[model samples]
Target: MTQRPVSNPAPANNPAPAYNPALSGNPQSATGRAYPNGNPDLGYNPPGVRNTDSAVPLRRDKPVIHNYACKDAAPGNLAFRWTYGSNVAAKNRDPRVQVVQYNEDSFVLRQNVCVHWEAPFTYLLFGNKGALLIDSGATADAQHYPLRATVDAIITRWAQARGRRAVPLTIALTSGEDVAQNQGLVQFAGRPETTIVPKPLHVMKRFYGLANWPSGTGAIDLGDRVIEVIPTPGTHQDGVSFYDPYCDFLFTGDLLFPGKINIGNDRDFVASLERLKAFAADRPVKWLLGGHIEMMFVPGKYYPRFATYKPYERVLEMLPAVIDEAIQYARDVQGKDMMLIRPDFALFNGVSPDQRTQVWPVGVPNINAPRPF
Candidate 1:
């Protein structure tokens, strides 16, 4: 029998709020909304937090699919396409800053540029003591000459706002991809010294050819404020979620998004979600800093219900259901002697196919199983 994809059940009666033009169209002006600046009281902070030495699981799962259609989609996946115009050339123009205060000290600064995407490249800046920049969009593509120029302008603007010529900024990465980290680093290299936190040394080495990238859990002292790196592996071995203690904000790379967690890299995708859940349980996350969406949060007046539905929490709560569905999908495909699985899903599948090979790992048991309903 063919399996159907599982769809999350809609919340009872509480049915998510109707799409309001104000909130949907003009999120910046939405009142009492949590994120990128709305209500300070709604922000999250753990009252008494303690650190545990437990590390995320490292054992790998066996390969399950060989000849999966989805695995063949990576190179052509529309999701990875950079249809948005380049950022390099736009950087040459003057920098513009728009600040949205989430609370008394935390704010998101958006620097506009001529990138293909309409949303501006956002810099999540905090005002505790020093400064922290979460995910410096695209900064190094030769085509995005404007993007690199724009980032430089923003850095200068940040320095001016802090009232220091050489204010140190800590750049945090969600992954080690060039568009996410390298490009931005190359652009910022000329500036005064800045500390960059990249997780899972292996990815850094493979992607940037750097053997010693920052690793492990630690606090980044930025003068007055402190940013904590909560290693959440899964999207990539080095994927990490950052928390700005003073500002009560969480920057969850691609682990969790408003609608769906991007499953481009499935194994790390699921693992990353688990890590995020544990991180949130220990530290209350007031705001969610996403890569594509500037900011996101669960909406409601009741604090407990709101907390129960925070984006990361919601993703964690729904993961088991998602995984079960994926497994069912594998079963159905196997029945048909065909396979379809997300390309990233192949990571933990145990079969080694050359990364360059287009063929999916074939002959694994129930490798082509169908998705569960």
Candidate 2:
């Protein structure tokens, strides 16, 4: 494949290594790798297994950006999520929704950049029969974000592009009971030609053919587009990562986004990361796109919780090795009470100084795991 034309991530301390090209059959592929193949350092090692003569394998190709999203903010609450970044209503543009066409077949829709900082991303992947709409946003009111109308617009566009044939949308949350992803469910529930994936854990487990938790893997075939449902239950018990081999895009709802990582069961979280690491290795992955972006422009920096607008931020596309770094970080600090902070994200059991952290579960409990907040 020809080299992709995109700006390289800006650098920071211990920034993720570049992608190695040795496996790509081109010595120049190593041009983008974080480490060289013959370095005798990088290899697959499970938790508690250390490569004595090798360097710790950190995230590969973690996006490095130039500056903070809010560096220009003068003072006051303006810099906070309340008001920051691109003005949604500058001239006459509506702030209700922003539809970005990544390609004819794939599109990304988000609540107004100003609607909510956590304006979780909603992805629509088109196929021969219909489209798969992943995640709702944090808003319920149509006037505020127009979730339904925006979806119709996408459907219309998709149909027109394909010789005027409609591609209906099948709605599914990245995880069950996620307020940020399910708030818009009510808006689409009454619409025609829409099927909402059942929210019950057992129902979902059966629907996806997942026989058991953590060990079971399932998939959904959207006509020709196939999506693997890799059970990732750390950020939330029911949380799962959707891997789209068609687009080489892994939509990790909350398992590993740009923001703070709120872990419920550390064991499950670590195990989940390990699972993703192995899954990614077997496939050709282009981008690991998560539901949200919280990593600020500078490396390892992040906007505080609820801070909406991020002017200087890392690219939405992240490296798959982030799973590895997170796993290693977890293994290196097992039961230490210290939440590991990395350049891309922070890990914790949703516990902090004053707030009450959720009781981290012992084993993979049912989907009823309480949240950190």
Candidate 3:
């Protein structure tokens, strides 16, 4: 009567079975009638209802080539200021060594002028295998300069940054005879995993594989990076120059600096300049970095020897064209022993090696007073 003859009647407490499109294998229809909404449990998309969401196509299945090899020498910048010396009275505030990162893999460190008036610049270049330190600096006392410890810390930090436990250090010099450069060599003595190239002329030449020194070239491979060593014996008998193809930088040490150039052998000096000029002619030379800066910003002017506070000191970098000027100057003063003043650098031929143009009344800069420009 009410249900027009019920085929199957459920108990009062029992519920009827729900419709399932999945069991019937037809998501759109339940038994016979079509369903308005697609069955989510059956993983069915509604007909004529395209998904509006944007999608990216699947990438092609292929073996990806991962590059683990080291890259080529990348260019870096040197546009930052250096740490010049301050008054001796306030020397406590100055750092023993001023380290400037030219790039992630290269660093330039300078000795504080107050620690030693020379304030020579040292270079630290990193390679995958090891590291190369160009110069130790002017001071021998670790308490004063701390060259070895500073270098070690730098190496440790560099290694840690690359997920390494330790990295070896190779210490080389531009001129082993120059006290201002080799004085700190003693500090690196007995350092583990550190190779200090012998400061002696013959030994250093042999270490770099410069059998035909003063003529042939040598190389130091720091894994991927290579440092070219050129025999430059004019500034000193053991004088050498470093050329970094990566940076296009020629580190001339005392051979060609912004300050006084004391020529140990005028003949050797001249020949070396010619060689450097020729080398720079074919290659791209960005800057010629030297060990020290003695000249002021003014052309043909330099601070006296042992002068500590140099506020108006000239920049440390020199151009390759200066090599041309250096050749001309060397030629003009070839046979003479005199001081030649120029804008970029001063030449001292046949003079005292430690001689300076400016004469200090007290033989040292008066740190209490302002430096005379």
Candidate 4:
């Protein structure tokens, strides 16, 4: 689905709003100002911004951007969602660009670019045996700062980190949402020699057809690390999950998030979550890497605010609830009802009524059980 660009509406006739210096730098003040605990107006403050005094300087050698926009329909509901908090630190603390380290075998490196906003995308360089990248940012408009430069820098840095040698890099998709994979391929295309593994057929056929695309589920075995692609349908037919056995990490593209799951594609969303749960049950998923949020699943903790139910032995634990929610929503409201009640169905209005009828099982009479996947 093509995302409509958020046109920066011209400033209102009223005098320009005063710049909150707190919003810019002061960590404590910014935290309070952005999220005043129980206040409805204050949204979620991005991670690292809450404690600014301890803010680590961004790696200067690389460009970075941070965004803090809430994912829910209600702008104020910031908790458990991902958002941009502050710009990247000016200095390079570690040139290695390790965003999060799961264990001795695995580590994640994040690229710096774009300030916080809707649909923020970050590049993750995963190192197992060889190197693999999860999701590329949207690069439709060259005018947009950092989006282009940020991705380019990451590609360069990733190569350099690998000693600029000819290393095979595989691109994995969480969802084919433009932000996650669009610009990512464009940037990688610049490096002709680098081995680019195409996403699996199940995902690609649904969102983007085989137009100027590569073939097969490109698997890379980098000695100690092995990256394999698994199809995760539901959120988007093209959605995929990456499993790194060396690190025991599962990059759940967009199947899950810290807070609410974006089951915009309801049926697949539930199924995708179920798939992840089943995988987690058998494997050691120490880290649930999210394309959007900094952390989605932290072991042994109930992230109720993010709609995470307990006893999360597998991805299925969250599925029944999400399916129930979507099914209930379809039953509760009129197909034409518009107050934008649910996030999953918000985009429903954007599509044709016929499409809505096809997608939503809600309001349909005698729909006994939830729609089967």
* Residue pair clashes in candidate 3: none
lDDT (Cα, 0-100) at 312 in candidate 3:
81
Query: lDDT by residue for model 2 over 270-325, one digit each (tens)?
Result: 88988888888888777777887776655555566665446666667787777777
Candidate 1 Cα misplacement greater than 4 A, ranges = 1-114, 118-121, 126-129, 139-165, 178-182, 198-200, 203-216, 264-267, 294-373
lDDT of 3 by residue, 281-366 (tens): 87778899999998887666678887778888888999889999899889888889777778777788988746555542332332
- Provide the lDDT at 329 for model 1: 39
Predicted structure 2, TM vs. truth: 0.69
Residue 258, candidate 2: alpha-carbon lDDT: 75
Candidate 3, position 103, lDDT: 74
Give the winner by TM-score: 2 or 4: 2
**Maximum-TM-score candidate:** 3
C-alpha lDDT (0 to 100) for residue 263 of candidate 2: 75
Off by over 4 Å in 2: 1-94, 353-373
Per-model TM-score versus the true fold: 0.45, 0.69, 0.75, 0.45
Candidate 1, 1-373: lDDT as tens digits:
1112224444596444453434332232344132222211111211132211011011213211111122111121111211222225344343333344443234454333243222323444544344566666554543443433554455555444334455456666766652543355555555566666554466434433333332345466554455666666544556666666554556665554322222344444455555555565776454565554311222211111112111211111122233344444333433232224332232223222222224544443323222212
Off by over 4 Å in 3: 1-73, 89-92, 353-373
- The number of clashing residue pairs in each candidate reads 42, 15, 0, 27
Worst 10 residues of 1 by lDDT: 51-60
lDDT of 4 by residue, 1-373 (tens): 1112233443478433344545433233545345333222112223233433212222234322222222321121112222222233233232222243332223343333232122323434434334555666544444442343543455455445333444455555565653544554655566544554445554454333334222223344554445655656554566677766554556665555433333445555455555555655665554555554321233212222222112221121122234345444433332433222232222232233223223433342322222212
lDDT of each: 0.41, 0.65, 0.76, 0.40
Question: How many backbone clashes are present in model 4?
Answer: 27
The TM-score that candidate 4 achieves is: 0.45
